[model samples]
Target: MRESAAAWGLQLARALGALWTSPNTLVGLLAGVAGMAAGARPHWNRRDCALVFHRWPWGPGGAITLGMVILHTGDTLDVSCTTYEHRAGRCEHPRVRLGDHERAHVFQYMVLGPLFLPVYLLCGGVSVRNPFERAADRYAMHGRGWWPGRS
Candidate 1:
């Protein structure tokens, strides 16, 4: 019994340590709070991550979803459909595409920690020149032909 208790305690401590050390987890928690405040509800879970959906308060019932800590905001964002669509229709799974992009951003957050925002801004916002955005786009577009139209 004592050995079991010690093992349980060690497990709990390890989990807490991981939580404390993980910048991605910290940023995700903050994103979760923001989503809740915006009347967004948890839509789904993917392994250690979650997806939240909400109606854009200022728009005409536009949908918004957050994956990882990246916000995919637009009038067309929806739970029923993928947030973005390729012009060629080559990518059949929109959510997966968006997830791929946002997960790459999450990796940036993990590496950059609190400096991501400033560094991203310094890198010229979300333009293709921005290394972070470029990396994400590459990850999201891997094996997929370029489709400029996303609605």
Candidate 2:
């Protein structure tokens, strides 16, 4: 019982740390709640990252709506049909995939907080020239071995 209590305490601490360090988690949770209200369900990846999968009401041609949350949150990725059916599972390489790309964006959120979106937009968003995208791409290519600051 004592060990269980200690474990629970540790888990609570980690959750608090994630919440404190990453403000995006709050936004993600809010979005996840919205998704839940719309009949979407949350899925957890191997990294324990949480994402919500929903059929977009806006139709097939709608913009990608996933991953709007800031960073360090449980519900980091928001998946629409496009992200779910097309991007993530199609990769032949285990490490390189859309999830990794999105996770990299999560890391960017961790560092940038609320400014990530604005800076990402100014840097061309997901374009090839965007540093954030490039960093994410590199992370997808190299797993945790890659990060933004390294050459």
Candidate 3:
């Protein structure tokens, strides 16, 4: 098992090296972007749900990438609700319930965005269909968010 793990690591290193040396600049760039987006989707979704609104951020995909990074690094600027408080005998609501799906959305974003976040930022924002969004929608409808009487 240890040998297999080491082999896997070596293979990964070689692949990365080849990518670094590849001549197809556009293809390499696109591949990197895809990888990052795939990795970040979960984290981004979670972060958005935990901190921001139920929808994606404004502007473009870059906004979401930035949001994921900020949230992951422990920075919460405009995040609405990320905590739950239950105070005994308090006049306010007894319990605060955070949206788990929302939190998961942030996680998704973080994983997919950072993979190639710098590229997108440097090249200016691009309008594109985020795979993460599709994933989140499916999850919300079929997974934890699904229930009787709920959309």
TM-score of each: 0.49, 0.55, 0.26
Identify the candidate with maximal lDDT: 2
Off by over 4 Å in 1: 1-38, 47-68, 74-96, 143-151
Ranked by lDDT, the better of candidates 1 and 2 is 2
Report, for every candidate in turn, its global Cα lDDT versus the true structure. Answer: 0.48, 0.51, 0.34
Query: Alpha carbon lDDT of residue 70, candidate 2?
Result: 23
Candidate 1 local lDDT, 93-137, one digit each (tens): 444355555555554554455566687789877455566655655
Ten-residue stretch with the least lDDT total in model 1: 142-151
Tell me the tens digit of each residue's lDDT in model 3 across 3-25: 99999987686455334433332
CA shift at 2, candidate 3, in angstroms?
22
By how many angstroms RMSD does model 3 differ from the true structure?
A: 14.2
Please give the ranking of all candidate structures by TM-score, highest first, separated by commas: 2, 1, 3
- What does candidate 2's lDDT look like per residue over 1-151, in tens digits? 9999999987786555455435566666576566566654556554524343433223333223233332222223333122221244543433345556676665566556666667778988655566676666667667753345563
